[model samples]
Target chain A: MALLTVQDLTMHYRTKLGGVHAVDGVSFAMAEGEAIGLVGESGCGKTSVAMALLRLLPDNAQILGGEILFEGRDLVKLSEHEMRKVRWRSISMVFQAAMNSLNPVYRVGQQIIEAIQQHLSVSEREARSRVAEHYNLVGLDPKLMDRYPHEYSGGMKQRAVIAMALACSPKLIIADEPTTALDVIVQDRILRRINEVRAEFNMAMMYISHDIAVIAEVAERIGVMYAGWIVEMADTVSVFKHPAHPYTIALMSAFPSIKGDKRVLAQLPGEPPNLLAPPSGCRFHPRCPHATAECVDEAPRLEEIDKGHFVSCWHPQRRSQ
Target chain B: MLRFVGGRLVQIAITFFLFLTVVFFLFQAMPGDYTKQFIMNPRIPPAAREALKVRLGLTDSVWGQYVNYVRNVFTGNLGLSFEHYPREVWDVIKERLPRTAILFLVASVMAFVWGFPLGRYIAWKRGQTLDYTITVAGVLFYTIFTPLLALMLLFVFANQLGWFRTGGFLTPRLWLTPPSSPQSIFIWLAATLAGLGTWAVLARFATRRIGHPRPRRLAQRGLVVVGVGLAGLGWWASGLGPFAWDIVWHMFLPVLAVTLIAFGGDMLLMRDSMLEVIREDYITTAKAKGLPDKVVRDRHAARTALLPLVTSFTLSIGFVVSGGIVTETMFSWKGMGLTYLNALLIQDYPMAMGCLIFTGILVLVAHLVADLLYAVLDPRIVY
Candidate 1:
């Protein structure tokens, strides 16, 4: 069994206006020690899917039907108390906006130490030592642990958050938009650091990013999401080389340089549909150039297209007799 | 600025005129004039009462009486007090005003001296046991304990302790011998104010990190420690000594009663403000560096949280200056509350109205001071 398996995971947010199908029937799995990417636009349900696996959705959010299995155990049925024990030790999350995720009134060292102490039986000094060790591991000065958050720059704050996430040495670290706020150089440095840490610790990671190039730079496998559903999934190099879904094709066409081709970029037509009232049938049919009459009436099911590659479309290709 | 002041000056003029008209009608609406209470005596005839009413202008129109009252008020002539017969409203107010001002002035000074730092401490240390304990105690005080506590203080010091005068500001001896000059009166004021000033100076300098004479600095720090230690001693001081103790003894209950009310609110507000500031993103950056809670709270959170409190402090002064009628009555200190209440009870309407105007002006001046402080404290808050 894979380290984590998500099957038929559907989540919606019940807002005043209407039900927003944020995470609509998304499903994926991650093998142990393997990294994966969940890539989509700003309002896509990528974040919702991540939060649902952790069962940390807000009050208005509902997990209508889903099964999340971690280490062959169903995480969907775990009690809050049981989940708390597993959070830092088994599955930890480094939230977006590192500045807001970390509490400001405490020293960075204390915050990391708090996560460690909460998860393990350790003395204050032991926790401090561990925090100092992580500081070195993340390439931050251990002595700077006593400094407050305001003294650090934006990139440093993100690094501190990453260090705090890795302090407990969890099996999986779900980094949601970890480097989106950083400058290009800083983002590259952070990605390189994360890649280095993954190799050293041999830890599995789920990297979410809006940029496909950034995701390809760090993530081993990629899943292209469109309108709360995964449209393509394959090995990173193959997915970059031969895109299947129209949305993924548009993304690849728009940024051919990420595939080592410096061609003129052709941007996609129109914006993503508002999730509150998504179109019936295939949600992306409105924007799909290959849409026929069948695509308008019947939604597409994800199917294997080639070895270790999945594509979701009603009229996928000439070979799909 | 001149135009704004000009407008306010016009407002003050119109308000004063309208106030006189209202006071004139409201007082005449009483069952009868001061002489009517005497009419209930069996010997007084109907013709004699009517004669008294005509002489007193009881039959004049309300507007006519208002004009006469306004004329008298402007000419430094406050009408005679009904209760004291010939004593003008100014004389009665002058006699009582000092007692009220001194008590509240002392109370305000005491509250700020201790309360500011204490409130700031609790705010900076929010969600800790000390903060929680103070908050719980404050909620208990404002919601449940204050009135009962006020009564208990009145009883314990009044009935059981024969140490100090139960109520009133000065000894009968001092009241009988009026000071001949403003210098003597000012001296009395200085003597009354000596203790708090000395304590404040000691606190301010001792808390400073700057240069001082080495020995003086050490001595000052020692004094800070000892003075803080001597809270019980100072508290006990209120119950000992002859005439001096009587002032402290009587004043303590009222001051204590008012302090409990004001401090509880100030502490609660400060704590909430500090907590809100701590949640800001900048605070998180500060924390990531491993700074101590005190540095985070005092240097970061407190500096921001104190912006609103400058305004709150002025409003609190207004509340204190108004004087708690019950606290003053319990202390029997003859402050404004007691003076105002005594006048209202006797239907000495003009004297009562004058007291109201005096308090109204004081509260307005305090609010004006708050507006000035707002511009100084928060640059974003433009006048």
Candidate 2:
């Protein structure tokens, strides 16, 4: 059985206009100790899905229909009290914007220790030891933990956040754009450290990011999301080499590769559909090159065309072409 | 930190000197002499009036008078009041300072104690009916005129209910007599020292347990003020020989009026600050850590939200020494507010200058303390 499975998970945000289908019918499963990247544009609901898995969505958001199963228990059905037990113990998150993700007034170590003491009945001294160990795991000096977030450089703060996420040895860690605010060199180093920590702990990870290149480097399996739906999910190598969904193909072609033939980067024609009043079919159909009348009338479902590979599209791209 | 404080002290000295110079010249520029108020009869000889002007140094040139004034101020003379003949300005201020200090101190404490938690709750419950109701109420209280509020409070509590005295710092029945015997004076001194010692111990513990240093430091300062104020009151009580509780009863209406007026702004400030802080990424991180809702709100959100309120609290303390002018006046409370008002009414320049100068120093010291507090509260803030 998979370590975590999100089935038919739908979430909506109540806004002035109407209910926004931010995470609509998103389904995926992660095996034990596996890493899956949820890649999408800014508004594609990848972050929403991460937040939903943790049940940390803002007050305006509602989990319309979903089942988040972790270790054979349905998390969506659990009370807030019960869910809190799962969070930080079973699942923890490294939030986006590392610069602001730690309280400014508190020392970084204090924040990590707070998380440790909250879930575990550890003495302050024991929690401090655990914080030091996690800090070392994330390649941050334990002494630097005494400093406030503003005192640390962007890369150091990101490492501190990763340390906080890893403090509890959670079964699953959701890293939501963890390195987005850092420089290229810092991002590379932080990502490497995250991979090392994950390997050591054997924890499942859901890496959410808009940058497919970063995801390609860290995620073993990749799920391509467009407008609140995962259009493709497969091993990273297969997804990159032979993108089955049209949206995935367009997204891949849009990036300028170092080794590929010199050509203008392919741009997807339109924006992600407005989830408040989404297009009445496959969300990517309007922007798809080969969208047809049937594509507009019927939404596609994720179907396994090959072992361990899924594609959601009315017209899956041919590998030969 | 020492260097920063030293620099601030030097700046305060310069500013105070300039203030003294300006105040002297400004009053000198006023039409008609202030000493004229001292003369009751026009039938008095011109020679007698001239001698009075010379004796008071009113006959000297502006430059000579300025020098004499600066020298006298440095020597702590503070000059004598023209309206209150033979009474020194400093003596008058000393007599009135404690009453004003206690009244405003209590009001400020009430404001902070009531405002902070209430504001934080409203912010945490933002967008709910409770938030809206409290916010509206806060706005109403904050915008109400000070004298009007004071009068309304006096009318309700003192007039309608008749539960407390309408005004005054003390009952007329209790005559305050200084402890003359050496043994009695020694006992009062020992009691005051004991109170100070107890406060010091509690303040040390409070600093350690309070977590955040800014509020802890504030609490420490507040503890000192309360301790000293209470000790002084105790000393007075001992001297006065079993006074009635009527003094406290009299203070109720004015303190309530002052607190009502001041607390609204503080609550609104805290609410707005907490609203912004709740949106910070750290709060979301705290929630994701499986911390309880209360922990997230208070520890993660409210701690950061308290930065602005720290500065505001310091500024409010600066105002404390001056007392609530309109509130004191409306309730007939004989605090520094009424003292300043009386000096201004009779154009008693010496007394006015002394009060204004003291207020200025307090304000300057408050800012310095605030700057120091910012560094303590947020490690990121450097002097």
Candidate 3:
């Protein structure tokens, strides 16, 4: 059985303009120790899906429908108190580290220790030792643990945040743009460290990032999200080698491959659809090159196009031809 | 840090001297002197008036008098008040300082004590009915005229309900036996507070290495409560109860009026600051840690939100030395503001300048203290 299965999870943000369809019908499953990368353009509901899974959404966010089956229990039906027990203990998150993610006034070690003690009935000494161990895991000096967030460089702060997320030894860790704000060298090192830590713990992870290349490096499976829907999902190699969905194809073509023959990077036309009043048919059809009359009038549900491969498009293989 | 403090002190001294000089010159440039009140009187002869001018130093060159004024100020002799003839400016200020300090400082503390939590809650519940209701209500109270609110509170609480004294700092009947002066009462209160504060600090330091946080915090709070209780009981048992009660009873309405008017601004400020802080990424990180909602709001959000509130609070307290003119006047409390106003109207240069200089020094010191507090509260700030 999968460690976590989310079926038809729908969430909307109630704003003055209207209900923003942020995460509409997002569905995926992760087995224990599996790593899935959800890559999409900014504001394509990747972060929303992560927030929905953790139930850390703001006041305006409303979960319209979903069943998050985790460990054979429906998390959507769990009370807030019960859900809190699931968080950080069973499932923790590594937020965007460079965006003041740690409290400015608190010691970095104290924050990690807090996460450790919140889940486990450990003394401060035990929590501190655990924090030190995690600090070493993330390649940070244990001495810097007592320092405030501002005292650390951007890369060090990210490492500290990663240590905090790993302190609890959570079953599943959702990392959202963990290295987006760091330099390329630091980003690569941090990504490698995250993969090493994940491998050591044999933990499940759902990586959220706009940089598909970064996700490609660490994620075993990749889910391509567009306009609040997962347009395609498959093994990383298969998705990269033969992207079946037109949107996925366009996304793949947008990135410059270092090894590929010289070619102009393809620019996908048009902007992301407005979620408040999203298009009636396929949310991506307005910008889909293979869009037809049927694509304009009817939305296609995600269907298994091959073994272990899913695509939500009227003409999934048309882009390959 | 010492260097920073020392530099700030130097800056304060220079600013204070400049403030004194400007006040002295402004009073000098006024149309007349304190002797103007005796202009229409025929009781004094010309020769006597000349002696009085000499005694008041009105006949000296303006530059020479300014030098003398600065020297006397540096020597801590603010000169005699013309309105209160033989009374020195410092003596008059000392006599009234306690009354104003007690009323305004108590009201300011009361405002923040309640305002901060209310603002935090309303911000946490933003967009709800409670939030809107409180925002509207706070804005209403904040925008109301100070004197008008004081009058309304005075009439209802003192006249209609007859629950407390109508006005003034103390009832004359209760003060007939002269239990103690207001200055002594203020001094005693300050000393007791200092003692309690020191005890609380030491208790916190004693428990700094405690393994468990929740119990340590509880014990610290318990110690403070016990300390305050003991102090209060000791004061009452020492036979200061009647004097204290009399003063409290008479000043209750004024303090309430001031608090009611003042807390709204603090509430609104805290609400805005909290609203901005709750949107920060750390707040979401705190939530993801599986901490309770209250912990996220208070520990993670409210603590950061308190930065701006601290700045507002310290500066407001600094202004306490200036005293509230409308509140004091409406309630018939003769504090610093009333004295300063009377001196200015009658051109009592020394007393008016004394008040202005004192206020300036307090504000300057408060700013320096605020900068230090910011560095302490927010570790990102270096000296």
Candidate 4:
């Protein structure tokens, strides 16, 4: 059994523009102690997948159809009261903007203590000691635990949020585009810290970001998302080395380094199709160069082209292997 | 910090000069006769009244009279009072000013002392039943008309219950026209400067200093606080009753009423200001530091959020003065507001104009004080 399985999960958002098919029939499963990357365009439903998995989707959003089985428990059926117990305990997430995520009027220690004490039946002093211990683990000075959030640098704030997520020692952590908002230097440091946490605790994580280069560094398995569907999923090394699906080939060709010596940077023409009313046959057909009559009429289902490697394109080998 | 204050002072002087010029011509727009109140109702011979007008420069062009009035004001003579039996405009103001100043200032302080902490509690527990209860109760208490609230408190605690004095500055016998001796002078001075309301509220809402915060650098902080308090008290003492105790005794009600009113406003403003500040991202950072919510709120948010409240203090001067319109009348206290109301009815033109000019100056000064305070609270905020 997988550590986490999200099968046929469909999440639609009712927006002012109309019903947005934010996460349409997305399916994936994670093994214990595995790290996966969900790479996509800005609105290609990566965040929707993360938010839906946590049941933290906003008021107007609805899980239209789905089954999210985590350790044999169906998370979708749990009430908000029951789910609150699961959040920050069974599953935790860290967002891109760490500073704004925390409450300003509270001390960093108190917020962590709140998470720890809220989840466990521990006394205040014990919660505080654990808070001090976590601060030390993040390489922050435990003595400055009484300071305000503003006193810390941007990197420190992100680390604090990471520590907060780890308060319950959650099995699976979801980090959504965590480095997208940080400076280049700070981004490297945050990624290093996240990797260390996983190594130390053996926690499975879902890393979401637009930068394929950053995702390549940490993600063991990579999933390229187009519109609301996963166009391709494979071992990171294999996907980086051998591009298969046309969208994946286009994505690799566009990033000069991805195709090794042969691939010079090549830009894809036009934009990702609007998920609200995407193309009938294939979401990426408009952007796919080798799109055929069959591609224009039939959407490709994800098929295992090789062992533990997946592709969802009619002409999977469009480019020279 | 010092530079911001200096700039504000210069701004205030420019504003004061412009307003002073405007007030000089206010009488020119009015249709009242400054010389008529002193004249009898019986028909004076037309010649005598005309002669009286001429002697008083009533026949002069409005500009000429205005120029002369401004000149006299500069020379320390604010002309004479038509409302007071026989006194100058300057004297009448000097006599009534202290009571108003003492009452207003003390009330403002008392209100902040009560409201700030209460507002914080309500904010910290926002959306809870206790928070809602306090918030609703505060709004309701503040909504009750000042005079009526005073009367109701008076009725329950004094008339019906005889727990406290109903209204008035002192024992009715101690009302002062002028000091008869040295002891009466002390009474006048004390009563005119001290807050009767603060005395009462302090007793009811006596709070020990928060954090059991032992004054660190005790000698230095203690002296500064005492010195500042004394300076403020001295300024207030300069304008009140003739004798010390009588002035202090009479100041009781006006001061108390002001304090009560301020209690609600400052606290409510604080509650709002704190709620807004704590919602910012920095609060979460503060929380992640492992500081308790209490320390985070008080140290991080409270001091920065206090800037708006300091700016708000400028507005309280107007409320205290306007509020004194009722406080003075209820207590039978003779202050600028009560005296102005009387002058309006009797059509005492000189007294009325004097009151208007006086209030306009006080309002301007209060506004200047508020602007100066901003730099002190948050030096980074430049406006």
Candidate 5:
């Protein structure tokens, strides 16, 4: 059985303008020790889907419909009291922008210790030891925990945040653009450390990022999202080799390759559709090169086009071709 | 840290010197000198008036008087008061300082105690009816003139209800002399011990019940009940004489007025700060860590929000030295405000200069203390 499965998860944000369908009919499953990368543009609801899995959406957001099945129980049905027990224990998250993710007033160690003690009935001393251990696991000096977030470098802060997420030995970890704010060198190091920790713990992970290259480095399978819908999902190698969805193909072509023939970077023709009043048909129809009359009128559902590959498109790219 | 403090001290010294110079020069430029009161008296002949001006050094050159003033101030001689001749200006201030300190300390403590929780509650329930009601009330209290509030309190609690005395630090009827007899001394000592004992017992009880669930709250309420009962018993036992109770009773209106004004500002400040802090990413991080709502709000949000409040708290302490002038006047409270006003009215240059200089020093010291506290509160600040 999968460690976590989110089926038909529909989330909307209530704003003055209208309800924004941030994550519409989003479905995915993660088996034990599996790592799935969720790649999308800025407002494609990538972060929203991650937040929905943990039931951590803000006050303005409403889960219009969904089933977040974790450990054989529908998390959507769990009370806030029960859900809190699952958070940071069975499931933890590494938030984006480590600078603001950690409380400025508190020492880094105290924050990690707080997370440990909140879910576990452990003494302060025990929690401190656990925090030190997690710090070591994340390639950080145990003494760095004594320092405040501002005192540390950006890379160190992100490492500390990752250490905090690993403190409870959670079964599943959601990393939401964990290294987006760091320099290129620090980003590579942090991503490598994350991969190492994941391998060591054998924990399931859902890595969310806008950079396909970063996702390619860590995720075994990638789910491409576009305007609140996952346009495609397949094994990393297969998806890279034969991207079925036109949106995925355009996104792939956008990434400049070093070794390939010198070609101009392909740019998607239009901006992401407004989620408040998303298009009725395939959400990507306006920008899809293979858009047809049927695609303009009917929204396509995710269907297996090949073994272990799902493409939500009326006209999918063929592996034989 | 040492260098920071040293720098601040030098700045303070310069400020003090400038303050003294401005005050001295401003008073010198006034229409009349301190000897005007004597000159206006018809009983004093022209020859007597001239001698008085010479004696008071009013006939000296401005430059000579400035040198003398600076010299006297440096030597710890604040000069004699013009109104209360022969009495030192420092002596008059020393006599009144304790009353002002007590009034301000009581009001400030009460304001913080009442304001912080109310502010936190309002922030937690931001869009609720309770938040709106308290916010409106806070604005009303903050905007109302201090003298008006004082008079309203005086009328209702003192004049109309007769619950407290109208004015003065003590009741005129029962001005008991200090205990000279052994029996009276014994009674005073016993009352003092009783008050101390009651407080100790309450503290011990509270400390013991710190972690207990509902009983801790119950114990706190019980402690207040017991304390009030003991205080009432002590008042009756003292034959209802003019004791500490009389001072507290007379202090009621003035303290209430000051507290109302202070409470409003403090509450609104805290509320606004907490509202901003709650939106910070760290607060969301705390919640995502699966901590309870109370922990997230108090530990993560409120702790950070308290930075601005800490700054305001120190600034308010400086204002305490100035005292609530209008409120003091309305209630006829003999504090620094009244002393300063009296000095100004009589053109007592020495006394007025002393008050202004003291206030300036206080404000400068408060800022230095606030900077030091900022470093302590937020570890990121090195100096």
Candidate 6:
């Protein structure tokens, strides 16, 4: 069985403007120890998928329809108490903006200890020792754990946050743009450390980021999201070499590859369609360069286009190398 | 931290000096002096009136008086009161300080204790019926006229139900039959409070270092119980329980009126602050950690939310010590506000200036304490 499966997940945020369809029919499956990346532009529901899996959404967010199956159990049916037990112990998250993820007032070590003591029957000493171990694993000094978030540099804070995420030894870690707030050097170091940690533990990771380059470094498989829909999903090599959905194709072209011929990075025109009133059919129809009459009228289902590859487009591009 | 405090103290001293100078000139600019009454009385001849002005130091150059005022203030001599002849200005102010301090300080603390949790709860339940109801009610009480609220509470609780005294800080009958006067009782009260505050602080500091959770918790509870028992025994042994109860009984109506007027503002502030804090990314991180909602709200969200409330509470205590004018007048509470008003009404410059100076010192100290507390409460704030 897969380690986690999210099927037909639909989540909407009840705003004053209207019901914001943040995550519409989003589906994906991750095998044990597989690292999958959810890559999208800002406001494209990448973070929402991460939030939905853990049921850690805001007050206004309504999970209308979904089955978050983790470890062969349907998580959507679990009570909040049961879900809480599942969270951090089974599936923890490294939230975006590590700068603000740790509470400023608390000692960083105490916060990690709090999480440890909550789910496990550990003595304070034991938790502290575990926190120290995680700190070392994340390439931070064990002594720095006693310091407040403000006392640490931005890179150190992110490293501390990563340590916190790893403290519980969770089976799955949903890292939502974990390196978005750090400088390039720190981001690269943190990503390399995350990959190393994942390999050591053989833990599944769901990496969420708008930057494909960042995702490419860590995720084994890639899911390209747009307007609350996953436009394409494939193994990292397949998605990079033969991206089927036009949106994914455009996203691939938008980046500069050092190995490729010198070519101008293509800018995808227009903003993402507002989720509150997204286009009727394929949410990406308005922005798709190859949007057709059928694509304009009918929403496409995520279909198996190849062995273990999925694309949700009426006219899936079959680009030959 | 010591350097920060030292810098703050120096700043306060300068501000206080400027404040005293302003007070002196403002009082000096008044149309007439306390000797004006004697000047109109023909029975008191012009020579007697002139002697009175000279004795009161009223017959000096404005500059000379200013210099004399500054010098006297520095030496802790507030001079003699004009209206209450032969009484030192400091003595008069000292007599009223405890009354205002006890009543308003107790009321303000009660307001905060009651308001903070309510505000946190309402904010945590934002947009719900309970939140709306509390916000509406809190805003109503907060904006109500102080005198009107005081009078209404007095009329209902004091007059109609007879649950408490209608006005005054102490029962006149209780003091009449006493070897222990109100002054002695106030002194005892002050000492007892100071002792308890120190004990609590020390206990907290000592208990914080305990390693084992169970023993640490037991120690905390044991400390509290012992402290309470000691305070009770002390009160009973002193034979002042009845007098203290009488004072407390008399304090009820005014404290309630003031608390009702003030707690709502605190509640509203706490609610707003909590709202802002709950939106912070750390709160979401706490939730994502699988901690229960209550723990996330209080431990993570409310801790940061309490930052603004701390500054407001400390600063307000400085101003609140001045006592409420309308509340004091309506309740007939002989507090600092009333005393200051009476002195100004009679144009008693020394007494008024003394009151203003005391208030200025309190406000300056409160601001310094607020800054210091911010550094303590928020690790991000380095002194």
**Cα lDDT listed for each candidate:** 0.73, 0.85, 0.88, 0.74, 0.85, 0.89
True contacts kept of 1: 0.07
What CAPRI class is candidate 4? incorrect
Regions more than 4 Å wrong, model 4: A121-129, A258-264, A318-321, B1-18, B25-81, B84-383
lDDT of 6 by residue, B186-280 (tens): 77886776687678778878999997878998898799789978987988887888887787777778888888877998999999999999888
Candidate of highest lDDT: 6
| Model 3 docking tier (incorrect/acceptable/medium/high) | high
Cα deviation of A165, candidate 1, in Å = 0.3
lDDT string, candidate 5, B15-66, tens digits: 8899889888988888987667777689988888788889888899999999
Model 1: per-residue Cα lDDT over A1-321, one tens digit each:
589999988888999899998887788889888999989898788888877766667657888887998988787888766776677678777777886766544566777776787678899999998888888887899998887766788888888888987887888888899988989999889889988998899889999988888899888899999989998898898787777788888887776554453667888888998899988888899898988888888878888888888888876543210
Q: What share of the true interface contacts does candidate 4 keep?
A: 0.19
Pairs in steric clash, model 6? none
Runs in model 6 deviating more than 4 A are: B37-51, B193-240
Ranking by lDDT: 6, 3, 5, 2, 4, 1
Distance from true location, Cα of A250 in model 2, Å: 1.0
lDDT of candidate 4 over B1-383, digit per residue (tens): 57766886788667766676775565456666755654675677667877867865678997787777767765767777655656888787876776677667767777787888888878877779998888877777667688887777667766786656655555545543543543345444445335443344443334333324454335435554555476457745665333444445456555676676677777778889988987665554344333455766787678667778878877677555556788788777777789888877655656776777777677777776776566445544346
Which ranges of candidate 3 are over 4 A from the true structure?
A318-321, B45-50, B177-240
**Residue by residue across A1-321, what tens digits does model 5's lDDT show?**
899888999999999999999999989888999999999899999999988877888888999897999999998899999988888999999997677999999999999999998899999999999988988888899999888898898888999999999999999999999889988988998899899889999999889999999999999999999999988999999889999998888888899888868998889898899988999799998987878999989999999988889999999976421
Write model 1 residue lDDT over B210-265, tens digit each, in one string.
54557667777777667655753654565322444445555677777777666666
TM-score attained by model 3: 0.94
TM-scores of chain A, one for each prediction: 0.95, 0.98, 0.97, 0.95, 0.98, 0.97
Chain B vs. true chain B: TM-score per candidate: 0.78, 0.82, 0.90, 0.75, 0.87, 0.90
lDDT of 4 by residue, A1-321 (tens): 699999889988988888898888888899978999998889999988988877877657999888999989889998766776777787887876786776544577777787787678899899888888888887788776677666778888888888888887888888888777779888888788788888789889999988888888889999999899998999998787776888887776666554346645788999988877889898888888889999999989988898888998888883454
Give per-residue CA lDDT, model 2, range A1-321, as digits (tens): 799999999999999999999988999999999999999999899999999888989999999997999999998899999999888989999888878988888888999999898889899999999999988888889999788888898888888889999888899999999899888998999999899889888999989999999999999999998899988999999898888899888888888888946888888887878889999888888888899999899999999987888999989987731
